[model samples]
Target: MRDSLRFYLGDELREIRDVDPTLTVLDWLRLSERRLGTKEGCAEGDCGACTVVVGRLTEDSQGGKSVRYEAVNACIRFLATLDGCQLLTVEHLKGPDGALHPVQRALVEHHGSQCGFCTPGFVMSLFALYLNEDRPDERRIDDALAGNLCRCTGYAPIVQAARAMHDLGDRTADRFNDRAATAARLKALADEEILSVGSGDRRFLAPATSAQLAELLLGHPDATIVAGSTDVGLWVTKFQRVLSIVLYTGRVTELRRVADTGDALEIGAGATYSEAAPAIAALYPDFGELIRRIGAEQVRNMGTIGGNIANGSPIGDTPPALIAAGAALRLRRGDATRTLPLEEFFLAYGKQDRRPDEFVEAVILPKPAPGARFRAYKIAKRFDQDISAVCGAFRLSLDESGNVAGIRIAFGGMAGVPKRAAGAEAALIGQPWSEASVHAAMAALKADFTPLSDWRASAGYRAEVAANLLLRFHVETTDPATETRLVGDRRLAHA
Candidate 1:
């Protein structure tokens, strides 16, 4: 069966399969559908101008929640991957009898718009904020909208508008729950095969089964695997990569599940970070902020945790965290499958230890010790959406006497691939959590790595910071009295 685009547009549900898989949602919204509310400021995912609301089916404890809305940048999002989801635009933010949405009214009253071009995207982004959770903190608001960049009106009034959304307190009164209607339509749509779009050179293919997917890929090995297209979409808008053979994974349900076992937590490769993150964050609170900063709520909602892992960018926020947790990958081909450590999966720069015919199916993460101490840190130019200069994840277990029992330290943006600080780990393995031991282990920094002198940070700076971060971790965990929790103290008790 063929996959199709299923989303909400104003009062009606839109089913779109008329464009190539490589085409971005921004183009579809503006050109094909003529929905101008979603703007394109920076073609890349950076600027939030192409923000649009995407509605996804959620599984609630009660049963199933249909079409939950979120604001995402349409610019770097592939249109074909939106199958079995709902997409909303600013024009649809209405209550019964033409009542204005809270975000719209608040923005209007606060004069949050100066150029008016950015207003629609900002409003939609805020509306997604309004729908997902109520009474978000300042940090949450900033993180939720960080992908969006605006020049006019600064951010004060816009921030004011974000806060006002909570007080209105109404739960989308006019928002209809067309669960049966939407789900049935989507069900009917996905129950077809050999789906193709466009008449001329522009075309897309969304195969239903992995076999069919592989067959298409065999013919077009250069075909793009567009699950969420968060990164690849950037290639088109930012770099203008003309993708010829595009494959959509949203139709392949085999790659979108999360499962738990006694030994490991198994997550499908196509499972979005939004879907897989909460479970992971629960297991490791140290990664809460990291997952939230993976992108905005929209990107998280649209992007997959496995996609982030598969993309294998040094700046990817999830890889360090996963490596720290001792995650493994499940790869599959036409009929055979295999599993391997995720660390071994990355061979080198722009390379993976993957078979040409095999693609990642899922990732299995071993459960950490209940008493183990954990931390993941991303040092970037900006707190969100910015590439990391040095990303670190530290996991430590201590003996009763405060001697290190076991340790795993992983760093991203420090080498050609995400690497473990083997020297640092060896230094702390048998040593007590004493200052002198930590000081001695700092010497391992030189042996472990010689980081690149990138624009993010100098090589010497990276080495110093990496060493000190370990010492700081030791102090906080082993001797709280020695660590100053205060920010101004500058005693540096963080990693």
Candidate 2:
């Protein structure tokens, strides 16, 4: 065991013994490091003013390890999770001779700054994008910058900068391209020793293996398990809640994998949305599209699908789709493990079937049956960086006679939990796949859920939208040429 944290801050090796388990990276950067370039806009993960780049060693399917860089919001990311990774801030971008990085240079040349408060965050985001993509189209550029908000109303120039950044210079010539050296440095910090450190009432324990995590969780059942910190970080910054015992699962290698078995897909509890998107997209295209809309690039880069399920938030965007796909949850307690249907895992709002000593191991999603049709819809006020008011998912399979043979419908934000719409499914099963059958299923939704009125949407609106989404799904699947989504070519018409 080691009572310290080890990571690379820029090219410098930082090995500190004294650390705060709940202290956010934003606070440490501005206070301890005196690096104010990374500003705090929302203090939550919504606004991307605190965005920074993190690089870590990632292993491919062939067991070849390389460094992968991604942009994350530092405001909600705890400092303890930085173990064995490289934390790069805006201040570290310039060369020793004070030459601006290509991203910064592009922003300056294209007049991407107005008030300049959010420029650093934009630079960091563009920096990560530049490192990862050799050429990013307009849609990709927009997706990369979705988390960032420019209050100065200067988005046109910023977008132009994103496009022109590649023309500035070759990305391979950048200092960060020395992947071998960075991977070696990160590998040096990797070890099986558990990290135990924190201030007075706050304690942090990071176990490198799943067995060790199970043992620690069994000993301290109440310990807060933090993987991405997209939601937990908000408790500290917005609510000012002090976490007593924090078990960092970000370091556990076993929980960060996504595997494709012959019959089912096994997604580790710590696998982020970005990591799992490709595999999901291949199986269910519509479901994969919903993942891109869950949050901006930063949130998707950090937030895990398992954390979304483990948190048991009814408004989470992934549950409805996963439940509709007939996924199952795996829980582990010490050496014992159990599997349960994902829908049954949620008991009620703010409550889950998870035991105090059990940890979410992985989510197993069986391959959709042959001829299965799946669709997921997220209804939010804004297209980006907004919580869902009502999310609905549908899976339908018709028999040779053109009647509904197997069907599963699930919804989020319509009830206390991510629930399967049993009544709706019953209304459609064995019925002809026609408008009458869809209407019956749509009407059955009211009996299945009585959603509450909230700021995002009203109870009546939720019910209406839920039904309309089912209708839209039917129309799209039945008539493949029909245009139901307005986001495709119609977006530019509004401009």
Candidate 3:
């Protein structure tokens, strides 16, 4: 299928008529156009070498022109995904009069660049921020450029440039409001084409619909599904996997939705960590912070929940919380769909139970129980943007008498895969809520799974911590030993 592509890189549309649609937008920008401002330090999304902004139409009160926008990594981002989306790159920073955009000008004035290789990526990310916000806070600045890295100079100046950019851009916020006609025209142009990128014998297919996407997948079941490419990109960039037929999900609007039915929360399969973070955090506060720390903002903006789950890394942070929360995954094929327990979706190392035609659709989460004690924790070497040594989730229910009714315990990076501690839960189930009970539950962890020693941690360290986590959970949920408990419910009293 041939699709039309429209992107405003300055004042012109680089409409390539009827090209293969699966090409990386970065490949098109760097190779086809020779813009070169966008770097490719890492072909994966993490390095921010190919950061770009997509100015999609957004609605506001005035509604003259919608100016809402988001920033994404261009390296792994497919060119077909830009069909109807406004493509903003570092090259667009110059005004018609040759004046630099606030971000670029500030970088110039503040000497934010030294070696200059990383400047364009950072500038584009900040420019995306400039187009979106009139006033950006420190946290906002941090969030906007989290995916970018500068090796030449200290990050302080770049951050200062962000502050100055916000101040300068705030003065003309109303003037920059996109004209309604312009936005309407752009939105009208969305999804106008399909382009595939081919290298050697490998082809990446990115169709705009499930039927079209499924046909590509069904025909090529061996094809790798590329959603955000946060991990698989690592396979290509670092481990050097020979990837053919990367089926990108960005054009699948059905996968970007988020819904709440009061009883349950649902997130589309392609919902990036950036897109679904706020809702996921609102439902599970403890887990929200973890999501924030998952890579940087750009990675979060590009990485999808389904991609993280599908990757099946033992260290993936989302699965432990998801498994503990009793979520379900929606999968779709040509015309058929199925839902399965989220925990059951994972089978082994880097493997899932999905059929050849099936791909993840959405993740459904039920409402938390009333007065239920819930918590999720991540133990990492560094506080931010680091992989976890261990991540855990706990949920507890109490009976009318306040005794433990049920519990779910899950952990990542402790075993071969993120798994529920069945033996631990069995020890706590129907047992009195006492120190002895906590000890019993902790001991059960020894029987659950024997952990392995890796570069991040040792087997003994994992086993000991896994068991101790249960006792710690007990102490955290119940009253402290130092504090006297006046429990009218005798069941909760000390033995």
Candidate 4:
């Protein structure tokens, strides 16, 4: 086992010892290392001023090593999580001759910086995109930059800079282009041994396998299981809570695997949203779109579906969609494993069916049957990087007679938990797929939930929007020519 955490800060290998387990990467950069380019904006993961890129070794199909670079928010990212990876900051983007990188040059030429506080973050994000993509469209650029916020300079110049990146020609000979050496370095750092860091009462344990994690959890039931730390990091930064024992899940390779069977897709509990997005999209496109809007790229890259479900927040966007799609969860405790329906896992607000020593192992999503229609809708104050006021997901199957054979409707932000609209589903089953039937189901929703009035929406507003979303679903599905979604229409027109 290694006592000290070792990682590459740019090209220099650094070893950190005896630090607090909850020390954030941003603080380590500014206070400890004196690398001041990465700024802390929100302290939380919301602002992108603290953006930085992480590169990890991945296996290519040719049985060789490669590196995958992902941009992450540094403010909420814990320093202990940097083990066995390469951390790249804005300081690493310059050449030996002091020439600005292509991303920096494009930003400079297009005047993409104003006030310059957020420029480092934008440059890092663009740098990651530049490394991954040669030429990205406007939509791709928008998605990549969604996590970054520039209050002064409007996004036009930044968008222009993103578009102009490819004109500088291929960067095959760049310093970062040689991933084989980095992959070799990362591989040498990888081991099956556990990582135990910190001192006294504050400690961090990163197990290398699911069995180790299960055993650790069984031994220390009070330890918090942290994967991605998207939500748990906020407890330290925003709420000023001290975590004593953090059992990190990022090192558990078994928990990070995603398997696709012909009948269903099984996503590991530790898989990040970025890892699960393509598989989720292949299974259900609407659910994919919903996942894309859950948070910005940084959040998606650092947040896991398992953590999202395990946290069991009432406003979480994925639960309603998963419940409606008839998803199930696999949980493990010690040597025992159990499965339960996804909706049943959520007992109430700030509560769930998870046991103290047990942890979620995987999420099993059944494939959509033929003649089935699925749709998920999220209503929020802003279109991107915002929490949903109300999230609705519907999966309806039609019989050969053109009637509603079966239906599952679930909603979040409507009740204490992500729950199914049983009354509404009961009203729609065996009924024809028409406006009248949808109205009956919508009316039945009144009995299903009495939503509370919050700052995001009033009780009456949620009720109305819930029913209207169902109506909109019915109209759009029933009429092939109806363009009910304004966002879809606009995106299509732009395309």
Please, what is the TM-score per model? 0.90, 0.97, 0.86, 0.97
Stretches > 4 Å off in candidate 4: 59-65, 483-495
The sequence of per-residue lDDT tens digits that candidate 3 reaches over residues 1-495 is: 553456565445667654443457788888998988988887867677688877655334453436456678787766755655677777777777898777888888888999999998898888777776766888778767778877778789998998887655553442334545457667666662444655556665667676677777788788888878767666755675676566777777667767787888898888888778888778777667668878877778778998888788899999998988888888887678889998888888777888876888889987788877766767777656778888888888988776789899998988778999999899888878778988888888888877888887888988787777677667767865712332211112222
lDDT of each candidate versus the true structure: 0.74, 0.90, 0.75, 0.90
Candidate 3: RMSD to truth: 5.8
How far off is residue 313 in model 4, in Å?
A: 0.3
Query: Candidate 2, 45: how far from true, in Å?
Result: 0.9
Residue 237's lDDT within candidate 1 is 77
Q: Write the per-residue lDDT of candidate 2 for residues 402-423, one digit (tens) a residue.
A: 9999999999999999999899
Better of 1 and 4 by TM-score: 4
Writing each residue's lDDT as its tens digit, candidate 4 over 1-495 gives 778898999889988888799999999999998999999999988879999999986556565667889999999989999899999999998889998898899998999998999999999999889888878888889999999999999999999999987676466666886787889899988887888999998899988889999998998899988999999999999999999999999988767667877889999999899888888888788888889897899999989999999999999999999999999999999999999999999987899998899999999999999878888889999999899999999998999988999999999999989999999999999999989999999999999999999999999999999999999889868876654345542332100
As for candidate 1, its clashing pairs are 1-192, 1-193, 2-192, 2-193, 7-86, 7-87, 8-87, 272-304, 273-305
Candidate 1 is scored at a TM of 0.90
Between prediction 2 and prediction 3, the one with superior lDDT is 2
Q: What residue runs in model 2 are displaced by over 4 Å at the alpha carbon? A: 483-495
Give the Cα error of residue 345 in candidate 2, in Å.
0.4
- Model 3's TM-score against the true structure: 0.86
| Candidate number that wins on lDDT, 1 or 4 | 4
lDDT of 1 by residue, 325-441 (tens): 888888877677888887888888788887665677889988778788777777776656677788888888888887988888888887878888888788888888778877877
